[model samples]
Target: MLPPDLPPLPALTRAEAELIDCYLEVVDLLGRINPARTEHTYGGLRAAQALVGRAAALRDALAVMHRRGESEVHAPTLARALRVLDGERRAGRLALPPSPGG
Candidate 1:
């Protein structure tokens, strides 16, 4: 059962949902990769490990945000989506993309 004090999760935007879906797909594919089917390269293994760690961090951050009532559920015209992304980035749960001018 959900904790009694926890707030309901914010509804996902289409973009947010799509991002999560794509991220999960990569995570799942890496998880199901057969060692026998892929070349035994340390680089691939390292990347997979990094992705697993990042995915865990992202999941945990999302849960904490939900429980703390720190979500975009009612902000129809504000920064719920940006807030989630920025909060996660600031907390080291996710990385911000490089700037176009950088």
Candidate 2:
């Protein structure tokens, strides 16, 4: 059985770690946005659009890392990013948003 608190094994390469950091920053930035403000302010909307775009690029980067046989330590991070992008029309690929009351 896996350790409940353990992260994925086999550590990240320098490049992979950089990508994860970028992904995390964008995710954190989006979390700071207020949905009501985004609907009204130009800057807020643009930030949301940029956040959505970066999430897609991160997905592609994760795919490349997978092809190169890196450890799956970033999987959970990617999943969180996807959920943030979910229901965002600008985000490419199929994304299912979190269910209500979930």
Candidate 3:
């Protein structure tokens, strides 16, 4: 049985899938590190934690943007892609290129 007032589910894009994968990886890492109780000792762990938080926030933001029915297709798509890439970068799965000035 379905709720009559509920809207249909939106189709997730490939970018969204990648974002989800990155998120899952971060979650797994967090789980592994949590028991060690060594987050304070390692800079990478703390950074990873921050990345998790940021990724979560980005996910929430994407959902809200999706629900708002914004007519600008490009905005939503770009936002979606960026969020995924950001998560990947944070997770150390993707290395960011050096800045031009460097």
All candidates: TM-score: 0.33, 0.46, 0.34
Give the runs in model 2 whose Cα sits over 4 Å from its true position: 1-11, 36-40, 74-102
Residue 36's C-alpha lDDT in candidate 1? 40
Best by lDDT: 2
Ranking by TM-score: 2, 3, 1
Error of 3 at 71 (Å): 6.7
Which residue pairs clash in candidate 3? Answer: none
- 57: Cα error in model 2, Å: 2.1
- Global Cα lDDT for candidate 3: 0.53
Local lDDT at 36 for model 3? 38
Clashes of each: 0, 0, 0
Best by TM-score: 2
lDDT for each residue of candidate 1 in 9-45, tens digit (9 for 90 to 100): 3576554454454455444445434354356677567
True-structure RMSD, every candidate: 13.4, 9.1, 14.4
Scored against the true structure, residue 66 in model 2 reaches a CA lDDT of 79
Q: Which regions of candidate 1 deviate over 4 angstroms? A: 1-11, 14-33, 68-102
True-structure Cα RMSD, model 2: 9.1
**lDDT, candidates in the order shown:** 0.51, 0.57, 0.53
Instruction: Give lDDT tens digits, candidate 3, residues 1-102.
Output: 974554332456544544455555555455445533343547556656677776775576556547666333554654454454454344443433456799
- The total of clashing pairs for model 3 equals 0
